[model samples]
Target: MGKKSRKNVFTPEQLLSSLMDNIPDHIYFKDAQSRFIRTNRAQARFLGLAKPEDAIGKTDHDFFAHADEALADEQNILRSGKPLVGKIERVRYGKGPIVSVSTTKAPITDSTGKAIGIVGITRDINDRMLEEERLKSAQEELENTVRTIDMELNIARNIQESMLPERLDQIDEVKVAALYIPCSTIGGDLYDVIQIDEDRIALLILDVMGHGIPAALIAAMAKVSFTKHIARGLKPRTVLREVNDELIAHLKNERFLTVFLGIVDKARKEFVFARASHPPALLLRKRRRTVVRLSGKGIFIGFAPRYKYEEERVPLESGDIILLYTDGLVECRNKGGVFYGLKRLERLLLKHRDAPVDELVKRIREAHVEFMGDVPPSDDIAVLIATLE
Candidate 1:
């Protein structure tokens, strides 16, 4: 057999040199006097030296613009024989621009436990610092945007409240009471009591589909429609038809509203009302001690142009109470996901039938709040009660 080839084994110095050459961090050794004793390939490259030996015997002052600070830190490490870990600093390499770095420096000891030199490893952190600054800027921008939106919403709420009537007091023809609560800063609910000539008064309540700014804008349009028709002395059915047509003309999207319009003719002692996919109005009769639900056949407004609406007429008597409301009053949900249905509302009204109109409204509101418990309302609520004197 041919002579066996001798195995090649790397010496410890060769192994150590290879490890320093392969690592990406700048590695160097400094004597107790702060003069460079040795350097790795990465450190030599940073110092613009052709090889590691080229950095031998050089101090930081030979290459760094701010060497005094680094020299003082190295002196402290020598005196205490302690390590400085992950110290962030800025330094210029050769003629390059200043860059951020995280550096760790440890003291080296001899056989007698006396400190001989220091070993330092520095990792570049320029990209990490830039990313942190960008995130901070984005967070500040988001906060400013949220504050501006909140201020604008407050202004919108004030304007919407100003458009609604504060109190529906007892008038010459009929006594009226009402309550309105919006789920947010603004609502999509609107109501009005307009005098249609001397003998007739128009009672109107409308609910747009959604909440917030878009729905509030639609409610504003409904207000304009109601005011225009009532001033023209239009009948309930005719007013709904006209408003439906106007809304269809104004909207280009799928937005719609449910409306209940009633004309109270004091001279004839009659209540003529029309509904457009809205919840039925309730009439409480004191003489019979019963309730009558006023409902009619019609589609939602702004859905189909020229939609025909049917009008319902009910004869009025002394001590008669008419309640008109949005679906929110009846559709309120509790914590158990149960709705405060119309049946509960009817029972409450009958229980407080003899109470004054204002007192009756307050009692109903209280009952609703109690039924809801800790749950919040999911929609806007509005109600109007008219007592025929």
Candidate 2:
């Protein structure tokens, strides 16, 4: 037979003492009067005492800086015979600094289940609380920075919109209408109908390489330069050359613009325009009931400081319509990723050839919206329409 087995057992007092001494968290028991009846070594140390016995018979008010709230909570637990679990609080013991702790307290009951005392456990949560506070502060700072940026962008957008022509006057026999839409708060597309003299008006549209703050700044610079050059009575090709030179001088090679500058010579009944890597201008002839593209060859502005732009002349007849637009119009994609190409634009123009120039502008904008559906244009769009009546 095997040797008789021996069972290792501990008394109730020995088990309680072992658990109270070994656990790192503070543990304590209190009478209904909220006076401490017993405390663990951890609780005594937390209260700046040398041993657990030193905490016996003392109340939290005797050692804690803010103990009124704690005493009230303990009384509530005693009266209700309920437990308060995982309550996070900031507390100070003796003369120590305030620390965050998570505390749990439950009513102690006798054999008949009558409340007789309270038992509690507390764990330090200072580090976790500090980290959470730091994260909340950072989140507030980020939100404030975002609000500041959005406000500035809105102001910039207003300034940019103010730089565009508020009204396109019917200079002599040329009637002009324009529409502009930006994909963001600010855009890089610019257009203007500036009167050079009594018989001539310069119609210009340009698209910077990208959109947003950087592109918007370049667009503003281009608008100012273009207006200044046109004010000097420069022709279409000369305006393009001067604007190109101005941009190349001040800007790095990373930024460039596609420009279409045209001068409507009402006296000669002709439209002479220059292109800088821009889409061709479309002419809708009411007499022929057809649309044609006035093509020209030129490089984008800012490509070369001294590059010369070529110009083309199209004699205008009564009721002829001319459409100048940025690539955003042709490059706009639908949900299916199909481009609203130049062919479709030309067809739309033909369909609305007999409408007034302003009415025709409205029609084109409507068509674009219908084609896009819920899909937004990926770039800024600018359209300028002119009619000879």
Candidate 3:
């Protein structure tokens, strides 16, 4: 009973004072007239005061006197009758920037419920505020990068679309349609149709050999160069020859172009085609499929100074149409990492040979979506199809 009484001897107020003295934060008390009354050990240590006895009657402003800091602090204590928490302010130490602190001051009340002195606690928060500011700046920078990228992609898409012939306009006895999808903001797929003469229609599908904006830019350049060459009266293979040399001179070691150029003569029912290390076009004749996988025997242009390409003529029947494409369509991968490869495409073409060209395109795209199983297409997919007589 005596030992228990000894433990209970310290009152709640005595325990609270012990807590204030031991805590790492600064704690102090001021009288009704804003005169220093009591201060804890923690308060003296924080203020660089040598001893708590020395700090008891000395106000912090008089002891730490850097400026009118004491007057401002006393004014704040007087205005807030209740506890005022988390007021941030900078206090100077020696040199450099004065770090900031979060301060709380509560009015002390006597037994009659009248306010007397004030109890104040202060916590330093300079590091946290600086870290928050750094994070905000990083977020702003990231947002700016995203906006710039979106703008560039929109500009590239507009330029690419403008280069396309407004409409294929049902050729004399030919039905043609094209589709191009870029997997990224910008990519390396191109397809176009040109009216060469009343009887001849020129068609081309080109793939710049890479990815991203650089690849897309190169494809646009090829469109300009190819169109200019043809307008100057150069033939398909001859234009390809000049393009090959020019591309080699322009592109660095890592880039090249795979292009298929063809002219269809409606009156003669003839097709003259040239392939430049490109994947061959697929000829869907009624119920049969032939992959002209044999591109002309030459290096992929831009890999060397000169590469020869040969042109071949084939008599296209009234019911036959050809499909030209980039590898992205067949090379698209699934969640299991399996490619929708050449074998799969060959089977689908044969099965869907009787369907309308647009239907075939739509269905194949849908099938690719299902096969990929929530994964995006990994590259650009470009397709061009023309029915000939």
Candidate 4:
């Protein structure tokens, strides 16, 4: 057998010294008086010391930025013999930037189980803390941006609603009732019942061809233009003709609207109306209990430069009801994609023919809600009910 050499074993102190020198984390031992008795190379480098021995015999109060707090924590662990595990600390040393550290401190016990000194290990967490702070700032900024947008939309909604006339009730010898519901914060539908003189009133209802902010803006422009024409004493057809020309001049990108303009002559007992590619107004006769659709051939406003609208005059008697609405009211869809058609609308009007204008509008709206169930409307719905009193 070959001669076997005796294997050398490292001494306990030598093994500990090797671990303290090689470990990446800062390691230190403090005496009972809180003086640094010994420290690893890593701890010395963290404190900007030339060598480990340079930190020996110095207390934490001499080097740490927040020394009083650090000393109090060390004293507590030494007196209670309780380990401080994973305590995060913020500190700066020797003019260096502030850093975050995860520190664990424990009592150094003698062989007899008596506490002698304090030993600690610290890991740098500056990079992780910095990243977390950045994320928190970004989240706060995003929330502020969302809040600002919500406020702007609310103001826009209020302005859009203000453009329509006040709730109609018995305007100029005619019983009037109306309802408006926008699918979003703003809508494209608009209506006005303007008293032109003591003997006549104009009822104008229009639907711009979309929803939201863009549609709302267009509707407002159309409302101003129509009001200007009315103030100029223009006829129903003349007013529509002027409005169509103005829209065609100003609007582009396929923007368009359908309009119905009607004038109720209380003295003449007649209703003269013009349609610009709009849904027909329903006429309910109380005596005959029959509904007649008042419709004519026309095109949508803002689509062409030169357009002519046909005006039709229907004789009106007391107790005759005229219902004007946007297509959203009749074309409302259910979950199964079925439309609340004109037939259903006419039947509802006949059912509530004798009811007051307000009650009639309410019941019809309720019937529509019941038909739709939980399905949301795809567009804005507006209705104007007029009874020749």
What tens-digit string does per-residue lDDT give for candidate 1 at 21-127? 99989999999888888899988998999999988999999998878998888888888989999999989977898988999999999998888889999888899
Q: For each candidate, C-alpha RMSD in Å?
A: 4.7, 3.8, 3.9, 5.4
Question: What ranges in model 4 sit over 4 Å off?
Answer: 1-64, 82-89, 93-96, 102-115, 119-124, 167-173, 182-184, 208-218, 231-233, 244-258, 265-270, 275-280, 285-320, 327-344, 369-380
Query: Cα miss at 372, model 3 (Å)?
Result: 5.2
**lDDT, model 3, position 67:** 35
**Model 3, 251-297: lDDT tens per residue?**
87688898998777899887778888887777766634554443555
State the local distance difference test value for candidate 2: 0.88
Pairs of residues clashing in candidate 3: none
Lowest-sum lDDT 10-residue window in model 3: 287-296
Give the RMSD in angstroms, all C-alphas superposed, for model 4.
5.4
C-alpha lDDT of residue 265 in model 2:
87
Q: lDDT per prediction? A: 0.86, 0.88, 0.75, 0.86
lDDT of 1 at 159: 61
Ranking by TM-score: 2, 1, 3, 4
Best by lDDT: 2
lDDT of 4 at 43: 97
What candidate 2 gets wrong by more than 4 Å, as runs, is 1-26, 35-63, 80-82, 93-97
Give the per-residue lDDT of model 2 (tens digit) for 63-139: 98668898999989988889999999999887889999999999999998988899999999999999999999999
When summed lDDT is taken over every stretch of 10 residues in candidate 1, the lowest stretch is 1-10
